[model samples]
Target: MLSDLQRETRDEEIWKIKILSEMQRLKISFYFWREKTNNNLSYTSLMGPDKLKILKEFDLSAVFQSKTRAEQIRALWNQFYKLYLLMQNKTTTKKIFCHESQAWLDAFLAPSTGHPNKNNFVRGMYRTQDVTPYIHVLVNHVGEFLEIHQEFGLAAFSCSAVEKKNHMQVCLYFQNTLKDGGHENSQKSAILEMLEHENQQLYFALNETPNFFEAPKKFRLE
Candidate 1:
């Protein structure tokens, strides 16, 4: 078993994972990695399978493409950001995406509807690229936030509103202006628990190479 400090560290990583998962659930476009037992490295998507299930459940055929999903998510997160601002009693024209972290931000805002207990199925590849995707764990929400924006093109993110419920303060970035992702969830508590406890210690450190996407030669948005 791990010691107190070790357990604490591990727990932190768990919370980070939860947060990453949340980003994925939010439909944030990002990828991640982990230091397995030395040789068992792996990477995965964040778009959440439930999204597909949701599409099937509601007969949503338009969300099958990757880019479409990305756009939808960007919009929802904007709304969440606005609400977060109201709770914080802060006023700013800047948006949240510009300041969000690399994979973390992508994953945090990945979910289209913030639905907890759902798989976001985040698209994108994974690799080792320093300064590409940021890194972090739990107990350092602010640091984590900073780390994300430190990456390539996210330095313009602006923390807007604060989420207040039951007297609890949750600094948020609910982007609602744009309509991109297909459809997702909105479980605030679940997302909170994941970011603060479950997915902590999960670092989104730098990689040698950044995940890239390929453009389709033909148009088929029917």
Candidate 2:
């Protein structure tokens, strides 16, 4: 007969294998690390949105589930959701005052005020895992930035729109511009072609009118 501790260990190993198999089925990549002391650690290659989707999709009240396993998973998912909400709250364009900044710091650092769950989540994550440099900056310096720029929010300083525009430009350039050879043995410059295409797009945007009504609700507003 197996001892209680041995049975528990066996169950844990089985659960780990099942979870890893499920992750593989979902096309999630698992990475294993080997350090100097022969310690093996593993993590999945899930992005932020992926993590959110997984946490949101997993239901604890589903049928044929182990209660203990479900509770453990739910607790971890709640922690991740709390962190997600905290990040979403911080990344907005709404003005944050000095007091609000302090509140945000409190919610970010210690688990005593504001949203204690989010604070505890961050604190627990920091204690258990290796956080990125961005997280380090978010924990230490973002509150200061918010306090100094109380007139505007962090969205004012975001580069996401610029990055997206650059991405679109690169796609357009690749699709429309010629690489090397052109008619009359002339070497066509892709950069020049891209600029001309951009100018044409701008001209159309400025001058062209839609045949269909853009805002039918506006026509009915009288």
Off by over 4 Å in 2: 1-48, 51-151, 155-158, 180-185, 209-222
* Estimated TM-score for each candidate: 0.18, 0.34
Tell me how many residue pairs clash in candidate 2: 0
Clashing pairs in 2: none
Tens-digit lDDT track for model 2 on 12-49? 45445555565565566654345558665445567756
Report residue 61 deviation for candidate 2 (angstroms).
26
lDDT of 1 by residue, 9-71 (tens): 545455345445654665655444656667543445424364343232321112222454434
> What is each predicted model's overall lDDT from 0 to 1?
0.37, 0.53
Best by lDDT: 2
